[model samples]
Target: MIAINNLTFEIGARALYDEANWHIKPGEKIGLIGANGTGKTTLLKLIVGDYKPTSGTISKSKELTIGYLNQDLLSYASDKSILHVAMEAFDRQNQLHTEIETLLKKLETDYSEDLLNKLSDKQQEFEALDGYNIEYKAHEILAGLGFSDVDQERKLSTFSGGWRMRVMLAKILLQAPDILLLDEPTNHLDLPSIQWLEDYLKNFEGAIVIVSHDRWFLDKVINRTVESRKGKLTVYAGNYTFYLEEKSLREEIQRGEFKNQQAKIKQEERLIERFRAKASKAKMAQSRIKMLDKMERVDDVDDDNPSVNFNFKFTKQSGRHVINIENLGKSYPNLEILDHANAVIEKGDKIALIGANGRGKSTLLRIIAGADKTFTGKSDTGYNVTQTFFAQHQLESLHLESEILQELQTFAPKHTDTELRSILGSFLFTGDDVFKKIKVLSGGEKSRVALAKALTADANFLILDEPTNHLDMQSVNILIQALQQYEGTFIAVSHDRYFLDNIANKIWYIEDHKIKEYPGTYAEYEEWQNKRKLQPKTAAPAPQPKKEEKKPVVQQPTEDKSKQLKKLNQDLGRMEQQISDLEKEVKQLETKLADDSIYSNANKLKETNSAYQQKQSALKQVQQQWETLAEQIMELEA
Candidate 1:
């Protein structure tokens, strides 16, 4: 639907895109990815025509309509209600409807052929556009984006910036443009809202290009990846996971080629240097020198795989029981954040706490971690259970004058200077980077520092609030791996599904002022969510009539009874087959887990265990049902 030809964009002395050529196909869901400051957002703006390229042309079909959700700045009147702003997307249809109404009224008064014809045309136009259901569609989109019923009627001024962004997202979804451009679309979305969006975009009938830092979200939503790196664009044919593997493979090939070319050039230079010392071979040496000069120089391959090392070691181990909470309750004057919250943490449960935004997911985390104690219930820690909390407001604790190395030492005073430096290096802080003041670090860098400090606390239980907020995909994956291997308990509030799916053993869903635990993987939770959405909230179906009771009578087997028994046996056999299949799958997963190679990586092992658990659960349920049918068949046989 859109094409870029030799596009070049430069800012100050840096080139964002140079001679970039790319195409956006119809109905393509493209994920735009790159390191921070690599100009992923800038490329989106160029496609949307917000910024003109330095050279070359960006062309789009004349009839194509584009909707862009930019993160830079959004404009909305504070006094306008949320609903009012969202409804503006359907202004054209609304105006058409209004015109039709006016023309109908005129037709009724004039009773002329011209007026009647005009009214007929206007009515046809309105119906053709499906104008009647515009209001309902708008409301549905708003609610799907996490706006409550009351929020729709509230003035925009009362909402925060995040809500305003949601309002903008609602409008864009309602508009249903030909091309959708979104930048950091999931930044403000909670788990439920993000899930809703994934479903919506999967069915969206248009080309979509989104810039998001959440690798898990992108992997779920986009089928293709478009990366802007250095000053060029590279396209990958699969999702974020596939992109990671493909990028690594491509870089390895490039590195090999570069190395071979460098070796050949050096060998030629050495040969020419030796030959030049002999008078008789001077001509040959000169010819070789010319050949060397004519050789096309191979550019040094960039560091294709920049590895980040984060080694977190605690100073001391904690007691067996890490954190304990009992009937925790917190309430404002009129609003209750949490009521009678209760949970317990042993030594090594990796828990993911999830809920809609503002439902107190963070509040519960803070309460258990002892950062906030203004609660009605009791919170107790086991003996010597040290705790470290990585809060959403972690940036506030950073000191401006402290270097990265000094900051680590400050958090972990018992560690030697060499130990502190080693820890800093593991988190990608090295040489001059270690000397940079805390205040000078970017938001992402500061988040890494905060995480490093938390890890160095030697706490048996860690409470992390959005720990992956500013980290890249690799960094997030590394953290997930580390947490999975750590011999401690973890309670974290995060919206990253892949991270949660890979690491968490249990999910604590906070909803309707209550917390509920579910024993399953994220895929199972998604399946449950889909089933819930499919189910209607109607009154329960009327109970079936009870079967008539038969009088006890001794009799010989009849032909009809024999046929019934045969059919029941057949059904029981089918159920047994299903149970057997499930058991086989579970056994296969178990075998994979037992393999030494697969178990070497903590993350892979965790994923395998989760799959094994799910398969086992399925097998148990299937076996139970199968046994029940078998019993029924046996009774009939008797």
Candidate 2:
């Protein structure tokens, strides 16, 4: 566990964290969330000692091990195979294996008892450390992260930055440190890999703090949430959804207190004025003034979630059919991206094209956007189909000499300055941030500017590839809301499920070298896909065994079946009741922990937190049991 006490960190003249305090408990999963420039990643770096705080201390036991995975690791290059790079986490076992090999070679000439004993010791140590299985473990993790068996044997330097980041992740996961600090772990992962990581991290023994913009991922993995705002860290007792509700409630209370304090101040000021004019009450008036001056004033809450009324004003509407692709065949020398793939995009169709990496999502987007002409099939754009395509490569089109506000002005010339600024603000460029030159912006910043520009185009159709890549949760929400109000046709390629579910009416995926369509939202598509996977596949029937030689039917006893069903139903009922009771207890404990008084009393806070966590664990166990029992009852009945 690590404790950050009164931590203060500054960049240049601005303070990122001002006396922020947070304690990371053992075995706890925490989601550190905030806007883009807030200090989520900075806190992780502070814990790992990569950056030092200006004041206060991050305390932990000397023996505690830490593993950090950040974007900076993308520059790490090695000639060794990815498997070898990951297996390097097992230092002791690898050393023992080398020693054992050396001893075996020495025995080929002089077979001394000392050499034999040394070899035995080394082998024993290696086996004790599970050295032989390390490679298997490494391979399993790498494959789970979307690496093929053949790719594992290739040199790490041969992979791209994104793939190399995956290799770094594999190495960090293999390290199995006491606490894992991941900054946007899902940024480089496709949908399948993200789900695999979610499952793996749920079963991970160590504590983890994830700094991510993926709201769905946080909801699936984190038990607690921490927000960094106004140079202070505030704890939310639950995940991202819970934090939203809790923060709203807290802000309501804060607003009420602020109003009441303002009224009280007015009353006190009137009384002081009335008494100050009287000779007899002069001393009382002075005392009242002192009291009012000493009172702690409550500050009103700021509206961080702004409502946008800026509409996307395009010049012309597209025809009924936005795009039409026929027998689309595209391939490279060693890879076939698409073959005889055909799809139709109609107007008003907000399509979400998604799949694992190495698929043809981007290529298809390019073809639809008319940026690629190498395909072997026909791709036509509908009438009056003016379009704007947004991708990572689009950043090159931006004028580096222009400022953020100036960049928006060029693309959205019809809009007022205030409207353009509002759009930029929604993308997290606020105040003087809009004045920064495009040349000085980082990749993420440039992505935001590009996305803002793309969304403001006068075209009737949009083709977006990974628009949510660099957006924070709030910015993504903004984009979702904007797209919801958009009347133009669009086809977007993204792995962000929340974004897809909120924006798209159809799901597109590539299968069997042909484009497939699911006429539903991403959530509905996921549910259907899951049920499809669970449905039993039909098998060929066994040859009718010579008419009368058929196997006799094995009939189960009615009494035993009835008893088993009854027991399962009874157990399920009990589990449901227990789960309900535990849920109440955990809620009550959470309320107790939320009290300001408890924080002032350390012992009370610790005891309440411990009880809350225990009840949560118990609730999870009983809920799982209830599910198992219900499944059993269903199977028996069937």
Error of 1 at 64 (Å): 1.8
Q: Which pairs of residues collide in model 2?
A: none
Q: Could you tell me the lDDT of residue 40 within candidate 1?
A: 85
Name the lDDT value of residue 537 in candidate 2.
57
Off by over 4 Å in 1: 73-75, 97-120, 297-310, 332-339, 416-418, 481-485, 511-514, 519-638
Write model 1 residue lDDT over 1-638, tens digit each, in one string.
78899999999877888899899999999999887788888888788778999998999999999989986545565688888888888867888888887887776778888888887787788788888888788789899999878889999878888889899899888899998999999988998899889889999999899899787789889999988887888999999889989988988887888899899988988988898999998999999888888988766667533343445555556543466565678977867887876555656778888878888888788778777878897777754567788975878889989998888887788888877776666566767888899988888889888887888777777889999887776567657766866777788888988888888887788765656565566666667666665655553554444457353232223566878887886786577467546655765775687589986798988898998889777867876786577556634533
Off by over 4 Å in 2: 274-282, 430-432, 537-638
Candidate 2's residue-wise lDDT over 161-183, tens digit each? 98999999999999999999999
Q: Give per-residue lDDT, candidate 1, residue 152.
A: 93
Query: What is the TM-score of each predicted model, taking all chains together?
Result: 0.79, 0.82
Instruction: Report the number of the highest-lDDT candidate.
Output: 2
When summed lDDT is taken over every stretch of 10 residues in candidate 2, the lowest stretch is 536-545
